[model samples]
Target: MLRLGCDVRVTDTDNTDKTPDFLAGHGDQNCHIEATTIDPADNPSAEDRNLEDAVAKIKTLDSSDFQLRLIVEGRISRTLSKNELEDKFGKLLVGNDPDEVRRGIREMGDESAPYAEIRGRNWCLRGELQPISDAQKVEGGSRELLIGPMGSYSGDASREVREGVLKKAKKYDRLDAPLIVAVNVLDIRFDRETENSALFGKEQVRYSPNHPEIPAQLVRKPDGVFIQGGHKPRYTRLAGVIFFDGFVPHNPRGSVCLYVNPFGYNTALPQPLYELPHAKGVDGRLNRVEGVDVGFLLDAKSPFKNSGQP
Candidate 1:
C-alpha cells in the first residue's frame, strides 16, 4: 500500500457502502476521507458536485476535522478555471507556495489567526489529484530541456525566463514541485535558405541550449528570439521544459499528449508544450514506443528535506 504520510490511515470503506474512501487521524482528531473516481464524464462541475457531496458526508462525522481526497486514473485536466479552482479550494489544499496564501490572507487583515488553525479547525477538505503513480513509484533522471527558435527569445528575454523559473522554484521548493519553462516556438524566424524547408538546416539552433551568448540575428518582430536548429520545422523548436516532481508520460517525438493537473498550482510555462526528438530505428526511420520520465530537482544538502507532514 502506498502511504502519503505516516499519520494518514488508509482503509477500504467500500464494504461499508459509504462513498468515503478512507479515514485519517491527526493527533486526537479523526478525519473522514473520501476518494472519488473521476472519468471523462466527470468534468470540473461534476467534480465540484462530488466535493459538495463529500463535504456533506464529512460534516456528519463525530469530529469536525475531515478531508476529501480524489484519486483518478490520470491528471485532472480542463475542469475549472484557475481563479475558480483557487477560489473554491485554495485554503483547503496545500498550494505550491504556502507563503503566497499566508501573505494574501494577512493582507486581508487576518494576521491574528494562523493559517493552520483556519485549515485544520474548519470543516473543509483538500482535493488531491492522485495520478496513477503514487509518490513512491516515481523514478528519477527523467528531466529534459526545450529551447525555442532563434527569433522567439526577445532581447534579454532569456534572463527573464530564467528568473521566472528560479522564482517559481523558490516558491515551490518547500512543496517539492517541479519548475517549468514555456517558450513560444511559433514566433521564431529562420534563415532565407531554410525558411521554406521542412528540415532545420541552421547550425546555431542545434547548440542554442548550451550557448553562452545569445545571438542577436535571430530576433523576432515586436520582441522575442528563437533557437536556430530544433527538432522540427517552425514548430520543431523547443517550446518549454517541464520539471515534474513525479513520473510523467514522455513523448520524444512530441505525439502523445496529456493535460497537466489542475488541482494544485503549477509554475511551469502556462499551457505551452515542448517539441521532442523523433523516435528512430536502425534504418533511421520512425518507430513507435511510449516514453515516460520522472524529473525532479535535488537539494545539495538534504534530499529528504520535503518529506513528512506539511
Candidate 2:
C-alpha cells in the first residue's frame, strides 16, 4: 500500500466509460491514499499509464490545501532536454549582484586567470563574458566556462552557464539562495528493446541510449531515472517515476489478426481453446477460473494498501 499526502481528495477515470478504479478522501483538509494493481501480465504498460493518470489527477486539484507526494513501484519513464532544464531553472542563476560579476568577468578578458575574491572567497573567470570575436574558454580549478556567439549554444552550454551563474551568486548576500532541482526514479525499464530507432521516418533519431548523459549522484529505481537540478552546492530533487510491466505477443500473426469471433457466448474462453471446433466446454472452464475484476479503492489516506510511504 502507498501513502500520499494531499490536502484534498483525488479522482480518476479511464478511456472506457466504466467507472474508474478510484478512491478519494473527503474533508476540508485530509491526506489521500490511492491503491492500484493490475494483472502481472499487464504490468509494464498498464503501470506507466497509471502513473501518468495519477500525476495528472494530482495536478488538477486545487493548489491551496495540500502539497502532493507520490510513492510508486514499477517502471516510470520521461525524457528531459537541456532546454527544459533551463526553462525550469534559468532564472535562479541570475545573481543578485549581476553588475558586479559582469564587471569581474569582463575584466578577466581572454586570459586563463587566477581566482579572485567575489565577496570574500576567490573565483577565477576563465572566459570573457562579453561578446566575443570567437568562442571563448575559461577554467578555474574544477570549473570550466565557455561563451559562444548568440544562438550558437547547445544544452551542455546551458549547464556551464548555470554553473557560472552559481559562482556569481555566491558573491552576493542579497540574492536568493541558488535554486535546486530534484528527481526520484520510482522505477526503470530493464528489459531490452530496440535501443535507438528513427521516429516517423525522419532522419532524426529518437531514444539515443548514449546521448544526454545523466549524473551519477541521482538514484535509479525500477520505474525511471531521477535527476536533481542546480549546481552541486544547491542541488534539489525535482521528479519521480513509477515503473510498470509491458506485454508482448507470443504469436505475432495472432496478434495482428483483427477478426472477432462471432460466437459471443465463448468470448471468455482462453486463447488455446477459443480456436477449437467445439469450445463450449473450454468456455465453461474459463468462466470458472476467471476472477472478478475488483475495482481499485481510493481512500483519503492510503492508495496501495500494501506499499509503504517513501
How does each model score on lDDT?
Answer: 0.28, 0.24
- C-alpha TM-score for every candidate: 0.15, 0.14
Model 2 Cα lDDT, one tens digit per residue, 1-310: 1122223222335434222222222233221112222232333344345444434533333211112223332233342233432332222232224344445547764242221111112211111222211222242122212222112111111222223223322332321111111111112221111000000011223343676574334222211111122212121111111111221222111110111112221122223221211212244221213211112112322343456754
Candidate 1, superposed: residue stretches over 4 Å from native: 1-4, 14-16, 41-310
Return the TM-score for candidate 2, rounded to 2 decimals: 0.14
lDDT string for model 1 (1-310, tens) is: 0121215444443556322234444344333232221122233234345444544433332211212232222212223344443444444443334355345545754342222211222122334311112232355333211111011211112323323333322332222222223221111121222221212122233225576586535422211122223322221112213322212223112222221222223323221122221122235332423333212111222335556624
In terms of lDDT, model 2 sits at: 0.24
Leading candidate by TM-score = 1
